[model samples]
Target chain A: MEESLDSYVDKGLVKTYLFTAVIWLCIATTVGFLLSVKFWWPAFLSNIPYLAFPRLQMVHVNGVAFAWLFTAFFGVSYYYVPRLTRQKLFWVKGAWLLYFLWNFIVVAAVIEFLLGNNKGLPYAEIPIWINYIVVVAVVIYAINIFGTIFTRQENQLYVSLWYLMAAIVWSALNYIIGNWIPYYWATGNEGAMLNGFYFHNVVGMMVTPLGLAIAYYVLPIGTDRPIYSHKLSLIGFFALAFIYPFTGAHHYIYSPIPVWVQTIAIVTSVLLIIPVWVVITNFFGTMKGKWTKLTESIPVKFVILGSVFYLLTCFQGPMQSLRSMQKIIHFTDWVVGHAHMALYGAFSLFIFAAIYLMWPIISGKEMDKKLGNWHFWLGFVGFSIMAMVLWAAGLIQGILWIAQVPFLNTVWDIQPYWVIRTVAGAMMVLSFFVLLYNMWKTNKEAASMD
Target chain B: MKRSGNVILIAGFGFFLLGFVVVGLIPWLQPKQSTHTIVNLKGKPEPVNEITGAAAKGRLVYIHEGCWVCHSQFVRPVSGEKQYYGPVAQAGTYNYQLPMLMGKRRIGPDLSDEGGKHTNDWQFAHLYDPNSISPGTIMQPYPWLFHGSSAKPTKRAVELVAYLQTLGTDVAEGTGYKSYWQYKAAQVSAVSTVVSNTPQAVREGMKIYNANCQGCHGIKGGGNGPAAASLKPAPWNFTSGKWMSKYGTTDKDIYNRIAQGVPHTSMPEWATTLKPNQIWEVLYYIKTFSQKKTA
Candidate 1:
């Protein structure tokens, strides 16, 4: 604490994960923009087998969900654990091992996707051998995290630690079940059920809780105030743990999976509102008198904006799970819109906040505020237009479909919307480059200061 | 508070297990047998045939291509999908499929009953370049699946097409194709009737013609629609009246040809897509094109 030389929290490790995330964010968003282009012009970059729509789709998805967001979460975890526990990160060498192993899994998964050697399980398309490596990486990560907590100077565990701990356990179980049982042990109906479980759990249990851990930590820190109610976050934490795993089957409402499972998915999906409501209350309540600070502080502004987006996404989630809504929305770009609001709008924005809040600590210099705001506005405007366009297009497609119009007619109707979506996506794709430039300048300034 | 971390881990694992039981285990353990069928519309239980040979290899090609991401296999009963696609899909219908490409998104139409919807040649042509037979479609072309030309399908293409034809053969081939054939089987021969084209018939025929036939056959009944550019053997110009009397091609013969579809051509079986009345009306509308040639 006396010296400003290195860091007790391992700043080098934190920067590795955070910077890797920014690079992947640029690549992933650009890939995603190309995907939107393919909706209107399927031949765009489609002449090559590697650049085909299906190939790039897997790459774009894993790039965003696992590559960008997952590494960012790891950055937050490494940065927070030492601060929370008041102890140095345990087995520092093991952390670096995890860094290499995890990155290898992601890189390998992308190459396999392009090469058409994928396992053909949508998001779980990484070959089985690579999946095994992923399982190993998570286990090492779990041990490293728990070991630090186990040897902490502080006897009392903070609420963020609780969510972090639970998130890790759930993720370990999630990857094992999601990858193993579906492909190896079963197929057909059972395989599908497990795949569905794995699919939603990747977002729900893994990313949601991990991101919420950072939200709980940083909202108070970013605002320079303590959280609103510690007890409220506890209630939200437990509620999320119990309800999230059951909501997977909502992805397959009218599917041949048993009627009871579908009912359970719908009911549990609605029940998720409790935890979501609790988060909204806790977060907005923390921002009470510091609302003016949000005008100047990028981190506070982004976190608060992300919370509002999270509220919209979670409310829409349960409503769409209902049979009446699912009938229209399922298999449509409406779900794509909803997914964007969750992963990109809510969680990615939260990570953007985390990157800004922690960047000075990692790089030893504050990021440029002007560029940060530019990135923020571009992302917000671009993604907002994209989500709205996709939702309207999906609803129109759904209506025409229900009317028994030829399937091709719906495709024809959405051409204009797809073009608009591509434009909006381009703006979003452009925003990531702004962030990347900011990251580079900030690091350069820090290096010259040293 | 230190021990609370262990408790949280235990409790989290427990909740996940409970979810696993409810969402995954119970349904998997149910006593239901994996039968390969559901009853056809004929009130008879039709046994679903197991895909084998080239179709089996084609199934892998389908998976590798990630076709399931866009094309769903199941046809749900809700949303009046019964009329749109043939037969509400049952669980047993997909029991034999390995990963069960009963996909979620309908970026393309549900392929649950794609079998017999188009002839083998149409499948080859469509797969080679989707925009050829289907104008303005965003489906990616599979030129790699073919050997140099649309006509020269590689082994994988044939296998893929073979698998496509096996999609919903257990039930009726398609919603309209079965009904059209059934209705036509009972209708008396129309070869003797020199009846002129009724105005109502022409109007109805024009609507169906614009919807289905105009993609290949031009609006002016010339073989020059937007999709006609890439088609081999090209669409027949209905407005060219010289061929009808020279070949003694009767009106009845043309009507059957329209339903059955021309072989080795991009003209898909309207029987698979259009009802009998629609075909009859569209035929009358096209006949007016030939009358223009005579005029």
Candidate 2:
């Protein structure tokens, strides 16, 4: 009876994580729709100070990247880390405190940004004070995760542990370096270039690694296959860890930086294809005989599709980093398209898959799998349409811009594309509603399971 | 199995730490060279005149406005940009630029050679209201440049205009417009008869024209301007015969453009920025220069 009750308690923890994931995902998607509209119609929320594109863009990015993805990661880690280690969580209270702190930090940062106190870098828009809160939250998480690992009943650590452990440690270091707080405060206004440098690394070290780590864990587990080769996994991880930090300079290629710095960045960006290809080949190899499983399982479908997008986005990222390509694409909608594909198509889908896979184990019963299927298909179609439209629009914009066509020519050229983006964005909004409905249904079924 | 796993984990961590140290220190220890010496990439670089005291003062205002965020003073060797924006900007061009404003991002065009691009009147009008002339320009309006006096030119706007007119003056050295300001003042005084109908009407017209026409037509009525450098199928040189003949100098045509604006050009409708009567006055002012032989 005690063992049975402990199993139920474990399920309750999973429920908490899943609920948080779904909530943040809906919030992020809704904000994403608002941002999409702002691109075509700047006047949509022109009268409202907080709703302007600059402010809304920062909010949308933080919502999707940090709020939704981090919460979902927390949910997955809580369920899988202890289960894989054959141990109870080292500190449930610490985990709960970390969650609250994370949410509070995000809320405060968004409020400060809306009120016009931002660091003014893309993705690193949150203020200095909010960075402190985030660091504290990460520290708490690191202690809890590490403590659980140290106290595990299982003697042999799993592959998931490797990815998860590295993600936490690296992300913590990334936050410190990316913020460059002491250096920035010391240099004052002259630190803008340095700040840009740090900002690039934040995307490199924090977002990319965390997203890939989650994918590494979820893909193998959902496919019911061990990763195809441990050697390949090690190779991918090490190559990524080594190369990603330096590649941030690619964003600054055309700027007034020293030439060698830009050259170093371009080389590393190209070489990054090695790690990406390794991961892609390994995932495809593992899923080789499991094509039918994708059709049957909503979680597998989202994860596999996400992996495919990850491959496309990383490839395009290196191409865009090329000086000639950047000449046409930088400051245009092409970068926007790349950003959406990376953040929404790749990371968001993987987060959704991880939550779906963990929900039943946490709820101690099966959810209405039919609703999950509906959610998956809606998101899959919506994200694909949105990505394709943006890519089309971006290409049109790039060609016209580089051709030395009149400025008005490029603006007129992209009008039809903007209309398509709006339509695609509407479909994505509908997908969010479907996701909300599915999660709510799952919650109701979990209550009934008791 | 557990013992072997422990050994592997310890070894892995050590290898990772060693890799991190090596990668992090490598760049710092062997830093990239600080500078490069390029050969006469564009032939002997154009001769630069000594920076004037006033131009030096104007450079401060440029930096304060964060103008470097969008406007690149330096043009690259790339064919599309070079052909469109004039000759590629050389390193010698920036010899006198303190904390050089050679920016990234071409939201507007490079201003490497903006001297004698337009008349002082055009510059004044543009600085007052960009939509008044250029219409549909992305440049943020400089309302702060003018004193809030009822539509009259302020001293500050004139100084800023003085600064813009000086860009790319090296090419204009031997021409009658050797000094951009002296040429602009002479042009404004010479064309006083065409615009003498009403100072108030012309002032309102100037406001409308600046906001609408100044980006492509220039701050002055001269054809060359900052934004013109970036435009492909470049903006028409307003002082040229081809421009006047192509767009007729009739009152109706000028009024129609100012009131309704040209479709598919950066020119936007001035109906929002100007009153109907004000738009007519601006048309009258534009027609004054339409019949002129020189800028």
Candidate 3:
């Protein structure tokens, strides 16, 4: 037995990209609970044009950022590139034609953003011919993850393949600077300073270097212990690829460009708190005395609650890039609760702790630990009551629109914090239906005990 | 030191092309501020207007009806939103705009000088039913930009109200409403009847203020009144003490300036012959002519 069969790779394209990332995280938590009940029912289903809340908030922000966090980062880099290149998948039918052409280009971009056929940017709303089908499916997944790291059987190259080869070339150059030069060569405020370097380098170089390369490859293999330093994770991966490409023009601090390019985007967004505190202090110094594997692992308590929400989304992204806190929470709802505390509290709780550490090694069984602690306490108490009612209704609509008060009285005093952020987005859509019913009852109890 | 994948793909695509040549291709290959100035339509200044024909197909039907995702053309000088959306935005105010709706979201408001602020039948009754002309408007109601049960419109609501009457009026041309179209062509002709807060509606609001604001506020509200010597920031005097700190001492800000008139002034709109309690009995007989010029 070739030292146990499971040693090879493409576990059927990592169970079809984690079953299309739990069906686009239940269609992005039912289009983010109908865009948080259309922010306190603004004619809720506005005589349906695909249930408009501006195309269901761009289908809940491209179905939770590119069909559920880029199909759970291509099902955790096709189950850790053949278990860190012991060698296997160089091109198994080019990974089933990149999983049916990346879910038929995200179902033709959620039917071209529900037919409003958009391109209004924010995370590059699809339809520039689906950004050339996501630049030919990120160049056929960077030639099948660099052709299985040049025929390796393991030749020393970890630190999660240097953050998955610089997050697949910084997500194909942040989808051509956030959608082909602001959809064809810039314009006004130089296309809002190149769409603030494609809105914070598409979450700082593509989902914070693929969610810190699956939290530095699932925190030293769920605390057996290792990565405390390796030269401080190679200086927190070249200081987060040179300060997240100059910290996305600090989301254009005080707009009309030039202010020395918003003080070099507020000094590289406060030098991104030095690669978010040296990769969260090397994942809490590799959980020192294997801190009782956080009460016996459910992937080490979702890697210490996603490194404490990636250190509170890099300390509220460098104190909301200064300029007096972007003159009071720039465009309020406190940057929509710091973009859902960095895409659902720090990279969807580190892709739900790398899908509860690769779904019991791709459904061999084990889940139901009280349905993974009620899907991690209903996604950590519904993302802390939806990031404290969108940062206290964006500091009471930026101190009542800076005391001038009357913009419909701060939209009727933030309608009971938008009805408690639609009951914390319906308890984070009932924690993704308790994580798709505990990964369909741990894959039908491991295919009826094989 | 574990490197080679062609030196980490040429230093990660050379720090992604040196952060796209230091924040997006050298400020998109510099050079812009060529020439600028606006005013024209005979008020003079001219030099550029540019956005051609039917306001460039009404800015592609305002980017195909997304209305720049809840308006915002820029303004920001912070907090008084540069006295609520007028100047502030320039980088050659998007010289021939090729796609720069500069919108991020204000939810509503900040149309960066929403040109000639209302009228074209109040932007076609606030785009046909914005809570029937702003009664707690949360916007959304382009009654498919009109026609059936007519208010005519629809050539995409007259090219989206001729691209919102050319936003910020071709870069600061006497900040619009060109003298409220010569005071609504001298209000076609005149008025009389009144009632609502009777004492014969404060004696027909003192004969509707000596037949419409004593020619222009003077029979001693003091703004010299005889068409306030052909206006232009001349009027407002209601015996000074700065008329309730310049036109705002609520009562719904003097019944929304006697039903929305002020836009680039000459006053007019006494809501077509007053009457919301005869404009609250002519704002309680103009606060008793500002308490008879403070006694």
Instruction: Give me the runs in candidate 1 sitting further than 4 Å from their true place.
Output: A1-6, B172-215, B218-220, B224-235, B242-295
Flag the better candidate by TM-score, 1 or 2. Answer: 1
Candidate order by decreasing lDDT? 1, 3, 2
Candidate 3: C-alpha lDDT = 0.73
lDDT of 3 at A417: 84
Per-residue alpha-carbon lDDT of model 3 for B1-295, expressed as tens digits?
Answer: 3456667778778877897788777765656432244444345655556677887888877776677776768766886665334456666666557667877767666676565555555566556555433344465666666774226678878877877877766544453435322333234232322334446556656655654565457665676754454456555887656767666686567666755566665564554334355566776676677777669
What TM value does chain A in model 1 reach? 0.98
Top model by lDDT, which number? Answer: 1
The prediction achieving the highest DockQ against the true structure is: 1
Instruction: Give fnat, all candidates.
Output: 0.55, 0.04, 0.42
- Model 1 error, position A332 (Å): 1.2
Write the number of the candidate with greater DockQ, choosing between 1 and 3: 1
TM-score of 1: 0.91
lDDT of each: 0.81, 0.62, 0.73
Q: How does chain B of model 2 score on TM-score?
A: 0.47
| Alpha-carbon runs more than 4 Å astray in model 2 | A1-14, A181-197, B1-295
Look at candidate 2 and tell me the lDDT of residue B285.
62
* lDDT for position A23 in model 3: 73
User: Which candidate number would show the highest TM-score if scored against the true structure?
Assistant: 1
TM-score of 2: 0.70
What DockQ does each listed candidate score? 0.52, 0.09, 0.17
**lDDT (Cα, tens digit) per residue for candidate 1, span A124-237:** 777789888988888888889999999998787988899888888888888888877776665666777788898899989988988888888789888989999989988998
